[model samples]
Target: MIPEEEGVYVFNREARSWVKISEDGPWVPKEDGTYLAYFRNHICPGCKAFDRVWEELIEKCVDKLHAVPALVQCRNFFFDCSDRTASDTFLLFLVNATPQVIVMVVEGGELRYVERCYGFEIESVEDLLAFANEARERMRKYAEEGEAESEEESGEELVVEGGNWKEVVEKLRKLLLEGRNVREVCDERGCRFVVE
Candidate 1:
């Protein structure tokens, strides 16, 4: 059975356990880690074909990564937005097709989107592994960049370019809360300061 979490849940045949996933929700990611999310449904033949590939990939790469598989049920393109489950998560991620895999990263307690691997693009387990490896490398680079930024003085000003000043201010505030050194934000043309 799937656990009561704000994401998707899929049975890991290899592990013989249900793996909880955080595709899109209030659920936080594993501390400073990466999660591989598989979005698919039982009705889609493509999804079924990719399922075997996913299983094999998991069997081979389980020791090297954390993967979550979800079997979503979406009929007539309608989803219950109020519910927080695999179906709802599939909608949240704008998944219109089955067998889509996304990589998510947790940095500073916030969940961030990394990359995605579509089922049609995956021909074998090795393809999946390569995609996952690339995502992991990107996450590593992102973490390193964030760490380097945090080491700098917090008072350093940041020029945020955007058409919506209010939105930019809100984003800058969020970045500041996330331990980013955002001293100020301005419009793209630098006509006025959005936040200072």
Candidate 2:
């Protein structure tokens, strides 16, 4: 479980909304625990549309996964885009898009990114539930195996410039998640993406 001091924003099941748990740096759970995080921007239409189903998922996942729910609002930064304090948190999670669902696990104070799903892919509460179940299974594996390698560790770093968030997300989803070797500028304005 996340320590009270480290819990920055938590989901309130009764209110069915995100609540500020503490004014802290990084804004992610750090102590040993299983966490479900919703990453979004202030002005994203997809994030707005996902609210209802996200609330439903929170209710279901709390009991089913035994995971604490968290929220990261990426307000205005170009790359990381989280509200003032959580920008580093977004970068730490490598979230390049709004409306992303991530599952994180912390063991012995080490944080690991376990699973992720984009909002568009989650059509209903059931989809989110499936995502949660997968994350739960992965977390179990991590605990049993002792420090399994994460996606962030396996992939090379990507540096993107001049692209809109949507385009960057699409390209990254393909390159990273789908394991495609396709390389294309992410925007009409001629963006540059370099994998190093």
Candidate 3:
């Protein structure tokens, strides 16, 4: 049986036992980290049942990998369970189901969506470990490919002619890659950029 602190959407840290994610202090997904996120809602019985499996997986396998354990809740409270609206965190991960496990890797400022499995699909700890292993492999391969692509693009010249959308985008990307602020880069290029 899981401890009271270990129940529901609780994050276990070395310094703390269980830091519950509250509506006022929601846990934000890190922009640059390897994370094994468990998405769930408080009202789902399946989610409650899967809590043990998630905790067990963390205890047994987290040390073997770089992915940090994270609990993401769509509905922070039972009252919000009926609300169909998703939080920004859910939208960022494209999470649409409860009791789902997703491995996320943020490498070189790029977020890579790795493998995922529903809680019901994972019948045992071994099964969950296998999924994690597969995700790690995929992340490695993706990193290798990204390096190769960057090497090839490094020698290419950034030339924008007649304001072609693709070329303009590539220029902006290159500027951002060079560690220039988006607004500053756009201003230097006489281009207007807006986010949100």
Q: TM-score for each prediction?
A: 0.55, 0.59, 0.53
List, in order, the clash count of every candidate structure.
0, 2, 0
Task: State the lDDT of candidate 3 residue by residue for 1-196, as single tens digits.
Answer: 2333322244455643545444322233436776677776654567777777777776766665455676666443211333222243444344445577887676655554566777878877777767775676786788799888887775656532421333443444454336543221111112122222
Tens-digit lDDT track for model 1 on 60-173? 555654544344433211132233445445534445455677777666655654576678788887787667656767767887998898898487665544234334434434
Tens digit per residue, CA lDDT, model 2, 57-161: 665556665567787765432243434345545545566665787877767766654677778778888777667667757767766665445532565655554
Pull out the clashing pairs in model 2: 74-82, 75-83
lDDT of 1 at 156: 62
* Local accuracy by lDDT, each model: 0.53, 0.58, 0.54
lDDT of 2 at 31: 76
Q: Which candidate is the best by lDDT?
A: 2
Worst 10 residues of 3 by lDDT: 184-193
Candidate 2 positional error at 119, Å: 0.9
Evaluated at residue 64, the lDDT of candidate 2 is: 62
lDDT of 3 at 19: 53
lDDT score, candidate 1: 0.53
